[model samples]
Target chain A: MMPVEAFLRQDAEAVRPAPALVKRGWRKLLFGDVASSLLTVLISLCALWAVPRVLDWAVFDAVWRGNGQACFDAGACWAFLGAKWPLILFGIYPPDQQWRPIVVVLAFLAITLWSLPERNWTRATATGWLVVIVSSLLLMGGDTLGLQPVPTGDWGGLPITILLTVLSLTIGFPFGILLALGRRSEDRMMRWLSVGFIEIVRGLPLLTMLFIAAILLPLMLPDGVTFDNLSRALVALTFYSAAYLAEVIRGGLQSLPKGQEEAARALGLGRLATLRFIILPQAIHAVIPPLTNTVVVVVKNTSLVLVVGLFDLLSAGRSALTDPDWPSPYIETYILVGFVYFVICFGISRYSLWLEHKLSAGVQR
Target chain B: MARPSPARESTASASTGWRIAQVAIVLSLVGLFAWLASNTAQNLHSRGIMVGFDFLWRGARFPIAESLLPYDPTDSFGWAFVVGLGNTLYITLLVIVLSTALGVVVGVARRSSHPFASGLSAVFVDTCRNMPIVVQLLFWYAVVAFGLPDTDHASHPLPGVWFTDRGLYFPRLHLDGPLLPGVFVLVVGLGWAWTVRRRDQRRRTETGRSPHAGRKIVAGTLVAAVLVAATTGLRPSLEYATLGRFNYMGGVTLTPEFVAILVGLTVYSTAFAAEIIRGGLDAVPRGQWEAARAIGLSEHQTLRLIVLPQAMRLIIPPMTSQYINIMKNSTLALVVGYPELNFITATTINQTGQALEGVGILMAIFLAISLGASWLMNLYNQKLGLVTR
Candidate 1:
């Protein structure tokens, strides 16, 4: 099948011709790829030229030493953020006990990363989570752990934000599953109640729920029973997260075939046993991606803490902009906040996608 | 008949266990409910707060910015709620229009042959969708709004449109006569097209020739529209907006809240819609298109006749949910202060101090809207479903 020109062309393509200007053979192909690479490099350079300018403004031309007047330059006044960093992070927590928060934050991060790996999905993992929860409570809500008492209001910044997100999900996921199951129940009354609950919760905006939690939840309680503002926020977050999570779980449950449940039932499995052992595993596997997506959404929605006057990352960023010394750094502060949000969200998204592919790989027909 | 007694005995034992389980479940549920109710009552008693609807009729001292109805601060909380409902409807309608239009266009463009168009579609999807809605909203509010010149230095670069920090101001259309008549004519035209389509289908079945039903209906509708327009003498003209020292006049102005919400929703949702449409189109076999052309059908006819009808069946469920999402995500309007249900609920909560009542009303409104949409779509879905054994 080989023609004379094909043979000659193959030989020519393997080695370069003598004349550099002509750019024959491998040289021509190599040159094309090189040209594209060079073009890409040039584009990246142009795009990233602002980075050095930002760096120069942030560090080199920055006022690192100033408190107020010395930051009066055209560059970024990171010194303002520097001064208020602790206040922004820990809010009005007493100055002497700042290390408690820093320690707790480190512990929280360590435990979170430890629990994130799939290999840790065991009963021991649940136990570890409980320990972490107790430790974090003692660390943050300190009077009982031989540490100075720090009020919930004193909690602020990224720690509270993470706490709200993690705690909401921790409680919400189980209750959400129960709600989802109730919604899918054969008993008409139970189904209706669950449906009513989910629909009612889902229909209202989270802000209204937060408003209710802040204003009326206390009023709805017994005379002596008072919930702290942080607890109120937590309750509001749980309710909102649960409603959405219920929907996500419902999606998973619906994806499983009727035959799956039927098969389990035929094998002498009770409804609970079928659901627990067979149906839920397969259904939840199918929905890991969207479930993870819901988590990511929860993370972003944690920014809504600002509505209720909590000092989340976004609120902290806003507060940073308010400092009289560095009013012009609003853009820079917001950009930094946005970058942090994007990194976390994007990481979760990538993980979700990878999980989706892995789970669905052999099942592809 | 004789063997049934042992089977019944065995089944009765199983049924007994089921009864016990049901009893336990109900007992637990009732117990939880009682506990919650008692706790709530106790809390209410303790805080000196009465949870009732009595406050609903009380005068709300707060004023809404952009209510469709006449609402004064002296109005009752219930009256304020009506204003809030109207605003919610208005914003929902506007967002629905913009999002659906943008979604359809982007959905189509995602399947475009042109590399540039496809690339642009991908970029739009990736950028708008990958970014969180809150971040996008904040970006629009902070960067875009602040980057624009102040209202004092607002410009009218276009003939009848003004751009400012407040919002986009465009010329409002003023009709010489009642516009409802025009709408009636449009509805009548649709009816006429339906009748013509039925007749054309009959003709095609009888004659064994392909029906030119689409063309026939379109022509008939156009003729009916023009005839009705002429009869009604409904000539409409634009009244150009005039920018004065303080405010713009003679035009409908859009607030930045509406703009930001609309822009965010449209771009963010269009990406998902694009994926849905692309998936639907790709699901259609190439053989169908080839066979369509083999019958002397043009490219447009092949798409319209052979492709889309099949694709629509696959598209409707997802598309229906997307539409529902548009209604739900309209709540995002609250963040930008677009006077939607959530915003009004916030105001109501602030004004009447009836958190439960305000939230209850909001949930009811959303549920009504959602249920109404699903009911309508369910009917259409049933009709369009494949009738197979």
Candidate 2:
């Protein structure tokens, strides 16, 4: 037998060669094979070429403060953003009432965050969302609340985008579920009708749908009945969102074993009761992640309203660039708008992943 | 045969009440559509707008600014629609090819064991995908329109390639002499070469021997085509761009709008396509790779002959959806003022006051394309999928 000290020393030597292991890992990552070695060099060279140029443009040589004239040879015209951010965000809302849109934006954020936790996702949260949305719209449509009335035309920029996305989704969710159910229903007529509606809408691009809303809806409506561009666009988005979301929900519904419905029926629940209590809850939860992805898509697609002459966030940015006083800081303005879109969409996507993890723990797909 | 989803039919026959409810729902839906149709008629009649295809025959007085086909301002609206359609298809095809290539690269890189490759691809996908494509299109448009140097200070990025804010100009190729006869001969030669390739593959699979005449045939076909072109005086000539009075002339120009839309769509679509491809690749069992290597196959051979075929089945379904998305998203070209189908439709509606007809036509054409493409893809999917039990 080896001495106790000798054995202990051997064990210690073998336990954790942390630095050596890490060194080998780095070597493999960089130069494990000829292809990897070459790729490592190529990546480094590309980074060397691009990173500093980007850094200089975005930071080092950027103008932090000044008007258009100081931006003549600047790498980035950040000051242009400072001067134009109000217009970019409020889009011709009364200068004094700009805080209203800000509140609307905050209300949207508060409801969204409050409803994020799994335990918090109850009917009360949905009611909270409804209250928030109604209050926000009333705040904006201020004729009744003794505040200055802001016309829908003046309802431009980020609030429009956020509101459109949230409204379409909320209105479309139940309709989407109904469509999904109809498509899978035992009634042949119901199934085919649902299929036809979904396919027709899904077949058309959002741009074409917007064209219908903006141009054709007036012609299609009664002579005296007219809806503004915002209402028309909301209608189009709701229809489009319902179709897209239905397909995603259908996927979740299909994942369930038939025994679920059969078991619910065996438990003596009625059809509607089974769907509401047993089927829909599980099915909707199963697809919440994908539903959020579709929501992100809608958030992006709201920018298409710009094509319809609606003053969405993208349109606001474009209108801001029309100021001749500014030294045509087109790139800088676009970067700011794109960054805002990125933040909204990326936040939703991250939350989706987190929810997926939370909801799917120990559950095999 | 396609797999029918287990729809979980209602366990018992519906009660009379349920049947009545469904019938009522259907009838109400029909009545609603009928009401809308009559409402539309009344509105159109009151507005005194002509609602028919008759406007299509009239000259489209507006300028299209850009078209793939030769077009005049005096062209009929019907012809204008055709031109717009040609432009849409051209961009759609070009973007599809480019995005597939780029998406595949980024996707493969995402799975790379090399840390830099995977990390870089991850950043690229995240950034490009998170930003909306419309913003990306407008951003790219700005970059193309204002970021590039003007013609007077154009950048020569490569030989025969000029980049300017006005457009990108490249040396144009002109084939002299009878192009039809030379092209006919080349087509025949290529067809023969394709047959040879098929035979080679057939023989290889059957007898474990590839009598590789396919390559020789391909080479011979190409040489013969070149020789024919030379003999027929159909030699290709390059026309270099020269600085004209105001801008560069005499070479092909890709306008700022076209370039912006193309680049934007390709980059945005690539991110989604890359994610789909990555998922498909990840779905392929690791055991397959190890087994291929255990049988002494090289890494390249294992990928080409073993891994990709398995991964392809998983990839194609989602890829079809991605391709369809690309086609639909191509309409975002409207944002950059590219004269695509939606752009033409809007313009036609504006000029003719035929919004209903124009939108109807647009939706119908899009519907046909979407349905037709999905049908073809489903057929192809069945071929690649498991055989019927």
Candidate 3:
């Protein structure tokens, strides 16, 4: 019943729909109007040749169980992981009390996940983090609530790694903020002290710091006031991370406009009040991405605890390989450990990227 | 605008109070240092641990497996440290060059029109950057380096390059003739080429015409250098490795530890450098590229002449940080027993029981290196920075 002109218009519209995105992309990637297409094809061929071999070695031909003899085939011996999972996860924590570390790790993971969701900043979150830290310490340290007492030296594996990371960040973050403020203080002495501390700490490698902690720190302490290996490493880590974080916080402070402080002052806020209520909130928000990156670095650096003779996750895996039963399957063990690290780090990075996007979007409005 | 009053008096009191508080803080800090020094002194006295750099003059008596400088067990601790430092610098320089080259290629490939190449590069960067460097180093040492065939059955990848569990052996080139005359000729040729290029540039600017003499000058310089080298007979001959009962000899041998550290640092840093380079490239405006194309410049020419210069300004600062990171990371050679600075310091501390002195030396060396590197990079950055009107 349509008119001839309307019919003609409908036909034109139907005919004018561009090619599907897949088709266009396929042409652009493979048959790209020139030499680039050939390059794409060549790369595709190489990947095609490589991907299956890797998949075969990693999955199809991988041996998931049985003895070393069963894994003689030219593929990954995942069986080593299956057998050594407990040792890798719990280290030297007594087999009977392995559940303690498991609980602590779960609590830590829960806290991290709970903190991931975006919300208006509140004091309750700080309280929650505090509770998490206390509960983890109590659970790992034991002796209360009818739990067996475990010395800090007995702590190892993923629990220790996570604890060191979280504790260092939680304790170091405030100090880092303070140091940043001090570095920027109007008072010359405070500024010089802050600069001296940050530069000395940043100039040295974490290994050297750990060495100082494990070896020299004891000498500096008054007699009979001893620190366990874990405590010493934790102290070193906190100070080291504080120095780096101070730099990051300084960067954040530098980015703020002078108008912010002036506005706060005009509103009759004291210096401390202006910093706490106005400048700090904005500066910390601006630096969330880099701060998250520091968290990732902290987690990765926990592996250095191995050099200090602490059995972190990496050290636990290395120890597991020493078992005569799994002498030659170190590749498999390292890959498994590396995967765990990759997951945590990659997740942090993805979250940071997402946070950057959301923050930038907020700025645009 | 009003006359100063009692409020001014109170303000003066407040300023005086602030100054008093500042002085109190300074005094307290000085007191803390004094306490620490006394405590350290007492602790050392009780433990009978000597604290001085006098140990530097003592014989090391510990053999280093690999050293860039000649070292023996009889060498002094100072000489041992020098060897360690040389090894560190050798690896750091090689990694810087290799990572920079790899980063540029991968970064450009990331922006390639080809999806496959870009995707592969992205995967490489993501996988590498996410994993811990120590674990990667372990993998390189344990799986890649240690997994190589034993020396007796070393794999011959190239005619004179042997790959084995012990290390990689490659032909070392030796200059066979007088090098000074060849170097002089090359310098003269380069200077001549520069003069020609500068004159051509002036002419082009003044006359608004492209003489295009720079290319000819460069070619002429290269030919002249080749002729001079031939006349001087300044040839380089390969010193190939000869297989022995236990190991290869007569060639440059890169110990497995060195190879592992080199590969690990290169691969890890290349990922970060690629990201930096990509950021620099993305910072360049698309209009610039279009303008270059509009001006009849080819794609390669546009990239080489127009795009990279702008990108370099953005890249240099971050690239400098990456270089510092690489230098710091070379300390990880300890894990694989490559005997770099950190390892040497640790050994010195363990053997001498002078933890304070060893740590002090370590910190001082790193501080000097870090500060010197930053100074040089800042100078370079100032040169490359945009010239504002």
For all candidates, the clash counts are 5, 0, 0
| Tens digit per residue, CA lDDT, model 2, A179-223 | 999899877887898999899999888988888888877877777
lDDT by residue for model 3 (A105-164), tens? 888788778788678346787788899889889988888866898888888889988999
Lowest-sum lDDT 10-residue window in model 2 chain B: B6-15
Q: What is candidate 1's CA lDDT for residue A118?
A: 68
Candidate 3: misplaced stretches above 4 Å? Answer: A1-24, A31-38, A41-56, A59-61, A72-74, B1-21, B212-214, B217-236, B379-384
Root-mean-square deviation of candidate 3: 5.7
Each model's lDDT = 0.74, 0.89, 0.86
Residue B3 CA error for candidate 2 (Å)?
35
DockQ of each: 0.21, 0.62, 0.49
- What's the CA error at residue A214 for candidate 1, in Å? 3.0
iRMS of every model, one decimal? 5.6, 1.6, 1.9
Name the TM-score of candidate 1.
0.77
Please write out the lDDT profile of model 2 over residues B1-389, one tens digit for every residue: 99998666573565778878877997998898898999888888887987789999999988998988998989899888998888888888898899999999999999998999999899999999988899899889988899888988999988889999999999999877877766777799888888988988988999988787877887887888778877878768899998999999987999999999999999998998899889988998899999999999999999999988888888888888788888899998988999998888888888888878888789888999999998899899777786659
lDDT of 3 by residue, B309-369 (tens): 9999899899988898898888888887899988888888888988888878887898898
TM-score against native, each model = 0.77, 0.92, 0.91
**Could you list the chain B TM-scores for each candidate?**
0.84, 0.90, 0.90
Off by over 4 Å in 1: A1-120, A124-126, A144-149, A243-283, A328-335, A363-365, B1-28, B31-59, B143-145, B176-238, B285-298
